[model samples]
Every structure is written in structure tokens, then in C-alpha cells.
Target: MVDTTTTTASPGSRLLGLTTLVGLAGLILFAFVLTEPDVRLHPTTGEEFGQFDAVRLLYLHVPMAVLTYAAFLTCAVASAGYLLKRRPWWDVTAHASAEVGTVFCGLVLVTGSIWGRPVWNTWWEWGDVRLMTTLVLFLLFTGYLALRRTPAEPQRQARRAAIVALVAVLDIPLINRSVEWWENRTLHQQSTLAELKIEDLTLFTLMLGLVVFGLVFAWLMLHRFRVGWLEHAQAGHEVALAIAERHAEMETLDVDAAIGRTGGAR
Candidate 1:
């Protein structure tokens, strides 16, 4: 039987592709920042271009947040495939996406903290629904990855991981609406999808471009899934070799006993 699971790209090729994407993301982000003034003026502090002036940070923050969601969504879809078809590829997809999503979630939290300090006057706030929910989502996904580390039979492991991925995804929508769902009494303004339009429309377009660039997460997820599949295949091949060797030894012993019995009869 042929093993079709091996990756087509050499290790060097995969590394090159990753490097290219990272470089492209940096260029796009730089271009987006150069296009406009990112910071807004505060009416009180007389602070124009406060830390918020690092408007380019939005380019990083929004994309990381979006990619964090995409990562989990990928995990959910992959988990579905595992549940339905029992394929190792799907399990690989789940594990890889979960890991990637966790990384982006962490990025979003850190960038949000940096942006918040200058604008909101604090590094952390429990009163902010969006912030709190985002943190919770990140922690949940982190736990999901940890749970996948459990030692169990392959099929059982996949099923358990799938359940965790799908369940945790429920928080994505919750986090998005956290601000409206509960008022934190914070000075932070209420968030709205319509407000996403305030930026001269061109800025909105650039933001959308940033969102598309964020799909780089999907590309990363693809490569990670491929690596996972290859690892799973390699393990399978090793197991098969061990089983075959044992079978061959047992056959040799059976033939030796048969020959001795025949010689004694003769």
C-alpha cells in the first residue's frame, strides 16, 4: 500500500514560504501606517497622538484578533472532519490551528494592553467586556491545547480534542458582543461595527486589506497541518515495521519446529 501522506514541499521550501509571508505582512503593515495618522486626540489630556498615535498598532492588533478567530474556526472545521471521517489529517489540522490561534490571541492581548495603557490609563481592566472576554477566549484555547496533550488512543484523542475546539469556539461571538452585552462603567467608548466606518472610508478599506493579510494565519495553519500529517505518518511507518519484524520471527520459529518434526518422523 502506498502512503500518500508525505508532504510535497522540501523543508527548505516550507521555510522559504513562511519567511516570505512574514516579510509581506511587515511591508503591508508599514505601508498602511504610512498612509495615515493612526492616533486620535484626547479632549482632556491635550495629548494629541498619545500612545494611540501608534495607529499602526491597530494594523497589528486588529489582524491578530481576526486571525485568532480564524485559527479557532479552522480548528472547529478540522475537528468536524476528524469526527466524521476519522482522518489523521483532520486531527493535525485541529492541533495546528489551535496552537496558531493561541499565539495570535496572546499577541492581541499584549498589543491591546500596550494600546490601552496610553489611551485608557491602565494596563489591565476587568470592567471592559471585550477585554475580559478576549482574555477568557485566549485562556480557553490555551487549555484546549494542553488537553490535547493527554495520552490516549489515537481515535479517542482526536475525538476529545475536537469536542474541546468546537465548544470553545462558542466564545468568539460572546467576546465580540461583550461590550454591548454588559456596560463596564469604564470611560472607554462603546464599540460598534458602524464606527469601523468613521475613518474616511479609505482607512476602512485599508483595514479590510489588513484583515485579508491576516489570512496569513490560514497559510500558516496549512503548513502546520502538513507537518503534523507527516509526523503521524512517520510514526505509523515505524509501528508497521516493528510489527512486521515480529511476525517474521514468529514464522521462522514455526518453520523450524515443522522441519524438526518431519525429520524425526523420517
Candidate 2:
């Protein structure tokens, strides 16, 4: 019997899909429509300058960046588990998480660049500490993924990828703290949420965005894990089939030798 429950979508995943869709719709409504554009007078300049409409992008950008961090961290933990246990489950989970995290990290860079264009008057600045650190983090993970694709033994590949993930993950902390570590040289602003700069509906929407995107990340993880597990199962099945065929061939040789000896004795 086919395991439709796991090999395909289960009731729980269907429900999660529905919930994610609803949450995404609500996030879009609140972020794009209900929330007011960021408008504030500069303290020193006495001039009206804020992100304005562009601030809306933060609703998606901030949460994605946060989730990107979460995904990579999950990958690192799973990779550690794989190294210790040498289980296919841990390896699959680590690969899935890294794949998902890489996508999220890419989206973060894109969104940050778009948001930066109007606010910072530049799409990208090589000198900015936060930007440079984030770019490095992205590149490291990209290399990790490339290393995974390189032809090698399965165990060797997993081991190398796991080590790369562990090493690459170290960049996350620097990227996260770059703004604080180099506040003077960074173009990125400090955390507004930490400072309690937003109020009422605006804060609510931002929080809602986090919840919605978290759901998105969860959904992606579920599917990716399922796919990875399925692939692992298929490969194992193929290996087992080949071994069974080899055993059958050996048995045939033994039977032929017995028949030849009986005939010679007769």
C-alpha cells in the first residue's frame, strides 16, 4: 500500500496551507492598505523625510530576514545532529533547511536593496558594514549549496556539506550585529522595533507580518523535508534492489557449480 499520508500531502499540511494563505492575505491587506506610510519630521533638520510608501516593504523584508536566520540556524543544528548520528534523517533535514534558508536569504538581499534605494539614496553600498556582512553570508551559503552538488560519495558529500554549513553559519552573527558593531560606518539603521518607535496598528501589522512569514517558512520547510525524505527513500530502495540482484547472481553461480559436480559424478 502506498503511504499517501507522508509521501504526499496530509490533512495537517493542507490545513497549514490554508492558514498560510489566509495569513498572507491578511498581511497584504494590512501592510499595503491599512497601515499608514512612515511620515515623520527629521529631528535636527525640521524636514519631512521618512521611508514613506517605501516603508511598507519592511513588512515583508524584516520577517524574511529573521526567518532566514532561523532557517540557517536550523540547518546548522541538523548538520550537527547528522555528524553525530550519521542518520539520513538529519542529513535530509539539514539539506532541506539550507535550501530553504538560501532562498530566504536571497529574498532578503533583494528586498533590502529595493528598500534601500529610496531611503539611503543607493541600491547597494560596498562600504556599509551591515550590507557587506549580509552579502558575505549569502555568498557563503551559496558556496555551501554548490559544494553539495559536486560529485562525491553520499557520505562524503553530506559530511562536507555539514561542515560547510557549520562554518558558513558563523557569518550570521556578524551580519546580525553589524549595525550595532559599526553604527558609525553602517548605512543600515538600528532596530526600530527594539526602540519601540512604532505604535498601535503599525506595530500590530509588523508583528502580524512576522507571524505570517513564519508560517510561510514553516510551510516551505514541511514540503522541502518531505521531498528530501522521499528522495532518500528512493535512493535506499535502489541500493537495496541492486544488492538483492547481486545476491541472486551469486546464488545462481553456486547452483550451477552443484549441478556440474553432480553431472560429472554420474
Candidate 3:
């Protein structure tokens, strides 16, 4: 028997471990130090917006949304690459990124809703273009993932999934620009990073959050890609084993027929 198991970590896994540690430390600093309570005036009302503590959620919420977009963009690029290059690795990468993107997109929606409850006095606004478009974006990617799971030949499944990924990405721009495209219809505020008035500490914390989430996204994608590779490898191995077993069985049947024919001749 082969010694298939080993206690060694790959370079990629080591890098991901280090990143996870650093990201956790940064998030801790973000929670304890950088996110100290502070007040800001409402952009439109010219009145006090007392969400000093609640606004801390913005650090996570904004970064999660950015990471979600990053993952989907990665998926789209990988899908395009697979279509051009016909490499299995590209298809695997696209599938992994889409899965990660879906999870992060869900996080964005959850955090946004939590923030909205107190700030907007509503958990959701059906008519809000940004919110509604983001929901649609999430659903589209979910459908992309489901399409990947449909039973088909490996190449056919990959081709179908790549197409879905490409189509799903069309919604990304719409979700991103929905606020600007329908400015009056959205309750969501335009990006505060565009304004010069945001406090330095808040911006710093948000940047930290982005860094942490980016690292986390990288870590997840790496692991997911490896798992996909392993699954592909195992599938090929199974097919090889099945072919070999069938060949052995045919040889046995051939020998049995030869023995019976020899006996008849005698």
C-alpha cells in the first residue's frame, strides 16, 4: 500500500495560514482601537446622525460588498480564460470563485440589512434600486452555481457554467450603478469615500476592514480551488480503475471460453 497521507503543508496553504492570522489581528485592532465611537452629520438632513456605534458595521459591510465584487470579477475573468484556453484549471478557478462570491454577497446583504434597520428605520425597501438590484445579483450567481451542478459531461458542464458566469456578470455593473442610474429612487447614500469630509480614523478602519476581507477572500479561494482539483483527480482515478476492472473481467471470460473449446476438441 502507498503512504498517501503526509503531515506536510503546501506553500499555498502556509501562505493562507499566515494571511488568516494577520487578518484576524487586523480585525481585532479594527474592533478595539480604530472604530472608537464618533458622530457625523447626516449628509442630507444637516442634523446629527447618532449612529456612531452602529456605523461600525460599515467597516464590515462595505468591505464585504467590495470583496463580493472582486470574487465575481475573478470568476468572470477565469470563465473567459477557460473559454479561450480550454484549461480545466481555469474552469475550476471560476467555479471556486463563484462559490466564494455567492457567500460574500450574502454577507453583504445581511450586513446591509442590519445597518438599514436603525439608519433607515426599515430592514428592506422593495423599491430601493440598489437593494433590489443587489438581491437580483445574488440570485443570478446562485443560479449560476446551480447550473454548474446539473449532470453533464465534464466539458459540457464547464461550458454551460462558463456561459452562466459570463451572463451573471452583466448584472454586476447594474447593481453597482443602480444608485447613480436611479439616484432619486434609492435610499442608499452615495459612497462616503468620494467625500473629503469623512474622518481619518473611520476611513483607516474601513481600509483595514478591506485588507482583512481581501485576505480572507484569497484564503477561501485557495482552499476551494484545491478541493476542486482533488475532486477532479479522484474522478479520473475512479474512471481508470473502472476501465481496468472491466478489462480484467473480459480477460477472465475469454480464458473460460478457451478452456471449454479445448475440452470439446479433446
lDDT tens per residue, model 1, 224-245 = 7778777777778889989999
Q: Per-residue lDDT for 1-266 in model 2, tens only?
A: 22334455778989999999999999999999999998989899999988899999999999999999999999999999999999989999999999999999999999999998999899998889978888888899999889988988889999999999999999999988888889988988888888898788988998999999999998889999999888777777788889999999887787877889999999
Question: What lDDT would each prediction earn against the true structure?
Answer: 0.75, 0.90, 0.86
Q: Where in model 2 is the C-alpha error above 4 Å? A: 1-7, 42-47, 250-254, 257-266
Best by lDDT: 2
Predicted candidate 3 versus true structure: per-residue lDDT over 122-216, tens digit per residue: 99989899898889889999899888888888999898899989998888898888888899999977767887568787788888888888889
Q: Candidate 2's C-alpha lDDT?
A: 0.90
Please give the RMSD of candidate 1 to the true structure: 4.2
Model 3 misplaced regions, further than 4 Å: 1-11, 41-48, 250-256, 259-266
TM-score of 2: 0.91
User: Relative to the unseen true structure, what is the C-alpha lDDT of residue 66 in candidate 2, on a scale of 0 to 100?
Assistant: 92
Which is the leading candidate under TM-score?
Answer: 2
